[model samples]
Target chain A: MKGRSRGKVVARFGLLAALALILSWLESLVPAFFAAPGMKLGLTNLVVLVALYRMGDRAALGVNLLRILLAALLFGNGYSLAYSLAGGLLSGAAMILLKRCGRFHMTAVSVAGGLMHNVGQILTAMLLLDTWQLAGYLPVLWIGGMAAGLIIGLLGAELTRRLPPELFD
Target chain B: MEAKRKRFGRNDLLLVAGLLLLGVALTLALGVNRRDGREVVVRVDGEIVARLSLSEERELPIEIDGRIANRLQIADGAVRMIEADCPDKLCVRKGAVRYVGDGIVCLPHRVVVEVAGEDELGLDAVAG
Candidate 1:
C-alpha cells in the first residue's frame, strides 16, 4: 500500500510542477502593474503552497525547485534564474516553518512567505549588482508581495480543502 | 497534524494584519514630508555634475573623460536613463523614477542619478 501511494505521489508531483511552469508563463503575460519592475502576481507560488500541505515539505521544496529550474531553462536568463531561486527557496522555507510552528492558518503562512519572497529577490539583486540603492523598492514590493501571497494562500487553502485526503494523508 | 492545518483561524488573521501594518509603516516612514522630485540630482564619481528640473523635457548626455557615459531624460515629472555605454546596461533597465529616494545607478561608470524632493533641503522654489 505504501509503495503504491508513493508512486501515485510521484505522478501527482510531476503534474503539479508542470502546473507551476504553466502558471509562470501565463503570469508573465499579465505585464507589470503600476508600471513597476520586479512586481509580479507570484502565481507559481500557489502550486508550491498547495504541494507543501498535500505532499509534505520535502515534496513542496522539490516542486518549487523543479519549477524554477525548468522555467529558467525554458525562457529565462541567468539573472532572472538567480532571482527566482532566491525568492522561491526563501519563501518555501518560511511557509514550511510557519506551518510547523502551528501558530497560523494557511493564509497567514502564505502572507509571510509572499513577503519574504520579495525580500529575497531584492536582496539578491542588491548583492549581485553591489548596490544599496535597490532597497528603495522594498516597501513597494513588500506590499505587492503581501497582496499576492494573501490571494494565493486563500486559493491554496480552498484547493487543499477540496482535495481528497486518501491520496496522500 | 494535518487536521490542525485546515480552516482559517484567528492567528492567521492576526498574521496578515501584522504584515499589513508593517508594510504600511514602511511606506509612511519613506514618505513623511516627502514628495516626488522637483528635480533630479546627477552625480558622477562622487561629485554633482548637474541638477536637471523634472518640469523641463530635455535629455543630457553625461560626459566623463571626453566620452558620453550615460544619458538622462526628464519628462512628465519623471527621470530615466535613456542611454548608457556600459556592457551590462543595467542602468537603462533600472527604469524611471518619480519619487524621492528613487534612483538609477551605473556601477561601471560610477554614475548616480537620484530624485530629490521639494523639502529635502528647504525651498528651491525661487525662479530664475
Candidate 2:
C-alpha cells in the first residue's frame, strides 16, 4: 500500500509539473508591455500553488523545478536560468512555509511567494553583476511585487476553492 | 457561532502606508519628467543592441522596415518613439516613459527602448 501510494504521488507530481511547463510557455507568448526586463504573468506559479494545495510541498517543489528547467530550455536563454532558479526556489519555499502557517489564506500565501520571488530574482541579479547599486530598484520591485502577488494570489485563491479536496489533504 | 473578522495589524498598516509613500514619490519623481538630452538604450535578451543619443535640433524619422512611425519624435531634452508596428501600440501610447522605472517595450520584436540618466544604473540593477 505504501509503495502504491508513493507511485501515485510521483505520477501526480509529474502531471502537475508538465502542466506548469505548458502554462509557462503559453504565458511567454503574451507580449510584455516593456516596463522592465524579466516581466511575466507567472501563470506557472498558479499551477504550482494549486499543486501545493492539492498535493503537497514535495509535489509543488517538483513542479517548480521542472517548470524552470523546461522554460529555460524552451526560451533558449541559459543566462536566465540563474534568475529563474533563484526566484522559483524562493517562491516555492515561501509558499510551503505559508502553508505550514495554518492561518493565512491562499491569497496571502501567493502574495508572500510573489514578494519573495522578486527579492530572489533581484538578489540573483545583484550577485551576477557583483554590485550593490541595484538595490535601489527594491522599492520599485516592491510595488510591482504587490501587484503581481495580488493578481496571482487571487487566481490561486480561486483555484484553491475549486480544486478537489481529496488529493490535497 | 459568529465568525470574527480579522483586524488589520500594525505591521499591515505600516506596509500599506509604505507602499503609498513609495508610489507617490515615484509618481512625482518620474511623472512627466522627460529626458530629451539623455541616451536611449535598446536591450534584447539581456544584451544592448542599439544606443541612440539625440542632441541635435533637427527631428529624425525612424522607420522600422518601411512605414514611418506617426508619433515617434524626439525633441531637445526629451526622447520618445510614440509609434510602432506592434499590434498593442502600447509603447507608442506610453508616450515616452523615460525614467529608471519607465520603459517602452515591443515584446513581439524583442525591442525595448528606454531613456535613463545613466546606463550604468540599468546594468547594475539587472546585471549586478
For residues A22-141, could you state the per-residue lDDT of candidate 2 as single tens digits?
888887788766454455667888998888877778878888998899889988475578888999999899889877866666666776677778789878866764433345456656
Instruction: Give the lDDT of residue A29 in candidate 2.
Output: 81
What TM value does chain A in model 1 reach?
0.94
Give lDDT tens digits, candidate 1, residues A21-105.
9999997676444423567878898899888987789989999999999998997878789989999999999999999997888
Q: What fraction of the real A-B contacts shows up in model 2?
A: 0.02
RMSD, one per candidate, in order: 6.7, 6.4
For each predicted model, how many residue pairs clash, with residues at least 3 apart or on different chains?
Answer: 0, 8
Off by over 4 Å in 1: A1-6, B1-6, B32-57, B61-71, B75-100, B104-113, B116-128
Docking class of 2: incorrect
lDDT of 1 at A129: 60
Writing each residue's lDDT as its tens digit, candidate 1 over B37-119 gives 78787877656689888899999999988998889988899999999986567678878888776788775576878787766
